[model samples]
Target: MDLKEQYEKLLRYCYMLTKDVNLAEDIVQETYLRFWQSHTYKDTNKELAYLYTIARNLCMDEFRKPKLDDIEDYCELSGESEYEPEARIDSLVIEEALEQIPKDLRELIVLRFTNEMSVTDIAKIVGISRFAVHRRLKEGLMLLRRNIGGEAND
Candidate 1:
């Protein structure tokens, strides 16, 4: 697949991790730079994985730096009035619930649901077994349900 296809997804992933749109853009830029600079794109099939791995690493590095409270928050919610009120409310609730879960779980859930990655791909990126990814995803869903005050795994 084309690397551009993964661009927005990687940016969104980094933004969620860093909570700063400008920093997310910078991180994604570094991701692309490193990918190009390292010649890792020679194998086209693994390019997406490589790009994601690079982005994930950069996001982790972002966590190591001194944080500034002046950074602006990047909320993904759309302000379009065309969206149904109930749907908007539900989205807000789910987003808030997602924020409450552990970062690892939230990332897994986002990788699966938002990025549409398979368990194997997630395992490769996370350096974990498929079983662990499944377990974390299941546990994340349970926690999200509880946070939203719904039945478990509902």
Candidate 2:
């Protein structure tokens, strides 16, 4: 695929990480820049996936830094809207629920649903077996359903 298509995918992946469009764009640009500077990304077929791995690592690094009190201000400056009342409530509920899950399982959900990456691709990216990916996905979905106020059967 071309750079444009790869970029679109990167943008979506970054947005899933930060939930801020401008931050996502910045992360995508940084990912592309890193990819361009690296020797491993010359092949167009693997470039998209390579860029995603870079973007994901960057996001994880950012999350590791200490948070500031003005983080919300930064997010707003980046054009992220304040959540509506219901959405805010739902977000809080979800956040709380996600926190209850182990980091590994949460990462799997982020890779699978947020990025829309395939199970095989996720297995490759995460360096886990396909069976492990499937198990984590199933467990994560169950946790999400319970946390989001839905019945476990759903």
Candidate 3:
């Protein structure tokens, strides 16, 4: 993908991580800036993973800051007219279900399904083993299914 497309995807991923639009944008910009400023930009093959690592680290830094407010307060309802009501409802339902799961599992679920990231890429981003990524993904999906009242496979 081109830089513009990659930027958009990174923005979405950061949004998923931070649950705040402005913070996500700031983190994404800093991620790109840091990527360009650092020598790690030479590796073309692992660009996305590197970008994710930077964004995730920036987000973790933000989370470490002293803040008594809840991140969920930044959540906003979409007013876009393009999506059908059922689709929006389903999205909201799934998002709500996602909120009920553990944060680590939710991150894996979002990375795998929401952002369409590969397990290997996710492993690299999260600094975990590929087998662990797969295992956690399965556990996450099962929990999501249970939360959404769907028929979960054993």
Q: Kindly report the root-mean-square deviation of model 3 from the true structure over all alpha carbons.
A: 4.8
TM-score of each: 0.76, 0.64, 0.79
Q: Model 2 over residues 33-132: C-alpha lDDT tens digits? A: 7877864555645544566778888888777888666977766665635432234765576666775777778878877875577888788777789999
Q: Which candidate is the best by TM-score?
A: 3
lDDT for each residue of candidate 3 in 1-154, tens digit (9 for 90 to 100): 6677777778877877776666778898888888888655555335678778989999999889986565444344322223333447668888888889999999999888877888888999999999999999999999988988852331
1 or 2, greater by lDDT? 1
Q: Rank the candidates by TM-score, best first.
A: 3, 1, 2
How far residue 133's Cα lies from its native spot in candidate 3, in Å, is 0.4
For candidate 2, the C-alpha RMSD (Å) to the true structure equals 5.2
Cα-based lDDT for every prediction: 0.78, 0.72, 0.79
Model 2 pairs whose backbones collide: none
lDDT of 1 by residue, 1-154 (tens): 4667677778778877876667777999898888888765665346666678888999898777786544432134222224333337667777789999999999999899988888988998888999999999999999998988852345
Candidate 3 stretches with Cα past 4 Å from truth are 39-46, 69-87, 150-154
Clashes of 2: 0
* Candidate 3 local lDDT, residue 20: 69
Misplaced by over 4 Å in model 2 are 39-42, 70-106, 146-154
Best by lDDT: 3
